[model samples]
Target: MLKFLKIFCASMIASALAFSVAAKEPECTFSATEVYERIADNIVKIISFSIDQHRVLERVRPGIGSGIEIEPGLILTNYHVVQGAKLIGASTNDWAFEAQFLGGDPVLDLALLRVPFYERNFVAPEFGAYNDLDVGQRAYVLGYPLGVGLTLSEGLVSGLDRQIPLNTLSWTTRYIQTDAAVSPGSSGGALLDDCGRIIGLVSMISSHPQAENMGYALPIDSIMPLVGEIEEKGYVSRPWHGLYGQMMTPLIATLLLTDPASVPEGFMVETVEPGSAAEKIGIKGGFLPVMWGFSEILIGGDVITHVNGQPIRSREDALKTVGALEVGDVISLTVWRDGVSLELQAELEERRNFESDLWVNGQR
Candidate 1:
């Protein structure tokens, strides 16, 4: 009888313990297996091709690209994936759903796509904060690598604030660096955090013989807000700020810093093109290019310290502040001039739609 009593008592304790555990919130993780499942559910094969062959072979020789499913049916891929797609007449027309160009810029090498559910439905991949990413940190690379299937690779961030070329007038600017194995088929894949949220998009790699594992990915800081623009306007357009920034160094740190420096730091402004948005907004830009260490760097303009009441801590943050608003969206600023800070408001204007894919006859 004593043994029976003990067993019943233990059973009651176990039940209480189980209930307590169930009542607590769950913990997040960065698991390889779990990340793949997210990719499996989110990644789709982008088949781009010309229909001229569809008529001949009764099927098109579809080119493959990786895409992350954002909102149900909405996928994000590189604009190059759909380059000349409309001209080639790649399309969809059905009753359950359909898709059309939403917003993108071939110059930026970025594109936004929507798929209708009932009208179209799909998951908007969770986004991670790029501000949290540190140089030399470990991160996961997820995507349909080689246009095969969902896969993950591990690498350390090796670079920051890079400019990559896409076309004569187009370039992806201010990107994060990673040493992960990237391939042509990996374009538009997700560079995710441990919790399986996207922090960047695996986009480009250098084919130089002397190049190591250097590759670049566009930061999530640039992508998070784009979701809203595509949804509301079916497109997005904005003018280049037309200013180059340097971070505050221990030397320049004496000057109020508010931007990012890619190397041993000190802040400066350079490359403000005449008549650019930065000019119209009255932001001071550097007049001459200077040399630092072995790098010929641009320097000497007014340093920006804040925007819209937000303290400018890095180049990415400042870009985010301006990039988040529309072309006509107004943004205010506080800048440091020779150590004296001043404030101003600039109604943002459009000089180039760097984020739009709207084109015809291969021209905007």
Candidate 2:
């Protein structure tokens, strides 16, 4: 009788442990149809009326884009969509609500808007880990294209940590590249996982006729850090280096008429923004434009070898080193220019809304 009771207790304990382990595992994976059905209501149509710069008489130009609700009444979209908007509105098929600009970060091309009143108790979707996503994993894009009804397109993740130049400026940030079909009105839409969790925000696409199914999204991890600041402070105060350039390579050295071994590998400084910290420290922009393959590159600029005594080797390395800086922090740069090496120092300052200005002026 004693042995029988002991065996019975052991069996019960094993069953309980098995049940606990199973309960801890995630099981939210849904079918493709279910993902769309669940997320469609949260996807919204963004309409904006802004001043037209091209017209001699300033006229209100209407624009349409897509938005994703991150909270009860908070919408997140691309900053370029409503940069100089006189008025902005968001709507679903059921109801329309007026939206006010909460804040924006032009550097990241992200903006947050607030809706004063909402009809239903909206539940925001969960966010997935962007790092865990494999290159060939399934990805879905949900948005309104050309003011048509909400659409869903499925594709696979093409690449990661891509540095594509969107608009006129080459933004020094990471973008997740996918083969998903993104269109004119798809900006600010959500790149979702199988469980209907947002992994990225659709930002831009390669519209060249030759380029097919090339779309890019900003990873959600990059935006998570700025959410609180953007909500409270109205703008993300980014640490400004205010310098733009390409990474120096052996090919770039050859184009610049220099020996590959003679030129050090680093971030090649092409231009310094006017009135920027780099400008204050006497950094110079390139004047001579030479064709490097299909792109035009300037040669006579400073090649940054190190930042704050940290060796700058790759674009990722440079961004990682400088990205840790904050405004009011003093930074030091070691650059090689005109066959000479120089050390420059400057106190970091706020980057102006130059990107917004360029967009509003129709330069991009």
What is the lDDT of every predicted structure here?
0.56, 0.75
Q: In angstroms, how far off is 184's CA in candidate 1? A: 1.3
Residues 1-364, model 1: lDDT tens digits: 0000011122223223432111112125546677656655666556566455436565544455666666666777777666546421212222222346677655456667666555443356778776676665666777665566556787766555565433222222566767777766677777866567787877666554434555567787777577677656755566555555555455443333434332222224555545766677777776555444223444557766776788766655655665566667667777776657778777655655433322322322
- Backbone clash total for model 1 is 12
Candidate with the greatest lDDT versus the true structure = 2
Poorest 10 consecutive residues of model 2 by lDDT?
A: 1-10
Q: List the candidate 2 regions with Cα displacement exceeding 4 Å.
A: 1-29, 53-58, 117-119, 166-171, 355-364
TM-score of each: 0.60, 0.86
Report the lDDT tens digits of candidate 2 across residue range 239-323. 6777878778897788777788999978888877878888888988788898643345677888999999988899878778767
Best by TM-score: 2
lDDT at position 295, candidate 1: 34
Q: RMSD, each candidate, Å?
A: 15.7, 14.5
